[model samples]
Structure formats: structure tokens, C-alpha cells
Target: MTGRLWGLGVGPGDPELVTLKAYRILRDADVVAWFAATGRESNARRAVAVHLRPGQEELPLIYPVTTETLPAEVSYEGLLAKFYDEAAASIGALLDDGRDVAVLCEGDPLFYGSYMYLHNRLAAYYDHEVVPGVPSMLAGAAVLGTPLVSLNEMLTVLSGVLPADELYRRLVSADAVVIMKLGRNLAKVRDCVERAGLLARAWYVERATMEAQRVLPLADADAARAPYFSLVVIPSATAPGR
Candidate 1:
């Protein structure tokens, strides 16, 4: 019989946020797979480090390129396709051996998490299940003591990597906004938020729920650069009584 494949969301940088189901799976899984930048530790694995059992086989799927700009001839999509294909093949081999594999995701597996790539490749052929966890935007809002939305208000989640005009349009149209993937695009996102006339209402959060967590006004964030784990939250204007 083919072994089961588990996609476990460890949650937004906090061990406490891991669900009891995720904890149980991690403890029982024969192999723990996670993604990481080449030459770096896996942040997903780190988030659930406390619960990992001794002697569990660790599989680190090192990415070839993370934030680096691609060359003219090399496309980001092609690079990622090749990487995921190989990663899936490796994981597939383990599954064929009847070894239960649990892939750890930093946040909710379906919510912009890297596990989607693997799922796209392996889901059709494998028996798999995804365990949900708190996404970073929700965690950030919690840390800021703010509500993401109020009744009848729409919340839009946008990637900072979106083009300036698109970002500006969405920012202006949404009742509340969560801008994610704020790394090298911090200045661009900041400009869009400002152009949307929501700068003062925006808050920046980095590494939410982690020891190095920080929440500050978007205007005060160092636009020079931001880590990949950063995001900006804009509360709804029509929030209750406001």
C-alpha cells in the first residue's frame, strides 16, 4: 500500500499556533519535509522544532533562487518548475517506499504557501491531506490588536509583488487590505499605499508571532528593504463605530 502524504501547516512563526492534529502528525511522521533557501535552515521546520521527534528523517527542499533577480534568459517560472518537479520526484520515491511523509508549511498550506507546488505535482498520484493553520495576516492582525474587517466590509489580500497600478487600484477599492510578500517591493508597496491615501492607516508587521516580531506604522518602516516575512495591514475604514 502507498504511504500517506501529509501537508501540515505549522502556523505563523509560533509553535503555540500549531494545531493538535499537526502536532500529532509531526510526532508520528516517519519523514518531515520542508522548504528552505539554499544554504539556510527551513523556517517551517524551525517553527515546529520543539515538537519534532528524535530520529525522524528530515528532508530539506532547498530552493535554488529565492529573492534574487532572474537573468534575461532564465525565467522564474521555469526555474521553479524544475525545482518542484525534482522535489516531487524525491518525495515520491519516499512515498513509494511506504514511508509516511509530512511536509511542514510555514502557514496555511493553501494560503500562498510553497506546499502548493508540491501538492500540484503529487496530489493526483498520492493520498494526501492538508492541515490548516493561522495565516500570517491573521497572526499579524492579532499581534496588532486589530480586526481585519467588520460586518459588510470586504477584505482584499494582495501580494506586494503586484504591479504598482494594480496594487494602487486594489488598495483604493478594498475596505481593508493585507499586502503580503513585502521584501524588495516594500518601497513600491509603500508608494501604492500612499497613493491610495491610506498610508496613515496602514501598519507594517514583520516576523509576526516570533521572538523578533515587530509591528509599526507603515510610514515608519524602513523602506530600504524588508524581510520576505513582512506584510502591511490596512484596517477597514467602516469598522464598527469608526
Candidate 2:
């Protein structure tokens, strides 16, 4: 019999935020797999490092290129597609050997997490389970001590990489917003927020729930220090109390 595949959401930076169900599966899985940048440690692995049982095999899926500024001759999308395909094959090998493989995701696996790509390729042929964990946006809101949406208010989650005009339109339409993937797009996103007249209401959070966490008004956030893990959250304009 082929071993089962598990996608474990390790939670946003904090090990304790991992759910009991996810923890149990993680400890029992025969092999642990994680995605990482070319030369960086895996954040998901770091979050759960202390809890991992000794002797479990580890598999690293390192990205060949993480930035979009690749050579004009190279196709970024094509390279990534091939990378994911190769990653799926490696994980499939472990599964076929009757060894249960657990892939660690930094946040909820389906929510902008790297595990989704592997899941899409392997699930059709294997028995798989996805264990959801705390997502970063909720962690950011918790750290800010601000309510996201009040009664009848719609909350929109956007990527900071969006075009300026598109970002502005969304910011203006949403009653509350969470813009993620800040990295190099911080300046553009900040500008869009200001143009939408929501700068004062927005708060920037970096690495929420982690040791290096920072929270400040979006307007005051330094663009140079904003990493991909950073985000800007705009709470509801109207107050709704218990």
C-alpha cells in the first residue's frame, strides 16, 4: 500500500500556534518536507523544529530562483512550473515507498502557501489530508489589537504586487483591507493606500507573532525594511462593539 500524504500548516511564525491535529500528524509522519529559497532556511521548519521527532527523514525543496528579475532569455513561469513538477516527483517517490510524507507550510496551506502547488500535482494519485493552521492576516490583526471587520463590513485581502490602479480601486471599495507580500512593493502599496485616503486607518505589521514583530502606522513604516512577510491592515471605518 502507498503511504498517505499530509499537508501540515505550521501556523504563522509561532510554533505554539500550531493546532493539536496538525502537531500530531507532523510528529507521526515518516518524512518531513519543506520549501525554501535557494540559500535560506525554511521558515516552516524553524517554526516546528523543537517539536519534530528525531530520526524523521527531511526533504528540502529549494527554489532555483525566487526573484522576478531573471535573465530575459529565461522564462520565470516555465522554470517554476518545472520546479514544482520535479518537487512533486520527489515527494511521490517517498509516498510510493510506503513512507508517509508531511509537507510543512508556514501558514494555512491553501492560503498563499507553497504547499498548494505540490498538493495540486500529487493529490490525484494519493490519499492526502490538509490540516489548516493560523493564517498570517489573523495574526497581524491580533498583534494590532484591532478588529478587522464590523457588522455588514466586507473585508478584502489583496497582494501588494498588484498594479497601482488596480490596488487603488480595491482599497477604495473595501470596507476593511489586508495587503500582503509587501517586500519591494511597499512603496507602491503605501502610495495607493494614501491615494485611497486610508493611510491613517492602516497599520503595518511585520512578521506578526514572531520575535522580530513590528507594528506601526502604515504611513510611518519604512519601505526599505518591509519584507515579504509584512502587511498593511485597514480596519473597519465604522465601530461595532459587543
Mark the 10 consecutive residues where model 1 has the least summed lDDT: 233-242
Q: Supply candidate 2's per-residue lDDT for 98.
A: 94
Task: Count clashing residue pairs per candidate.
Answer: 0, 0
Collision pairs in model 1: none
Model 2's alpha-carbon lDDT is 0.90
Expressed as tens digits, the lDDT of each residue in 1-242 for candidate 1 is 78888999999988999999999999999899999998887889989998898877899899989878888999888898999999999999999999899999998999998899999999999999999988998998888886779778898999998999999988888899999999889999999999999998899999999999988999999668898888998888754321
Per-candidate Cα lDDT values, in order, are 0.91, 0.90
User: For candidate 1, what's the RMSD?
Assistant: 1.5
What does candidate 2's lDDT look like per residue over 58-114, in tens digits? 999999888659879999989999999999999999999999999999989999998
Error of 2 at 7 (Å): 1.1
* Error in Å for residue 168 of model 2: 0.2
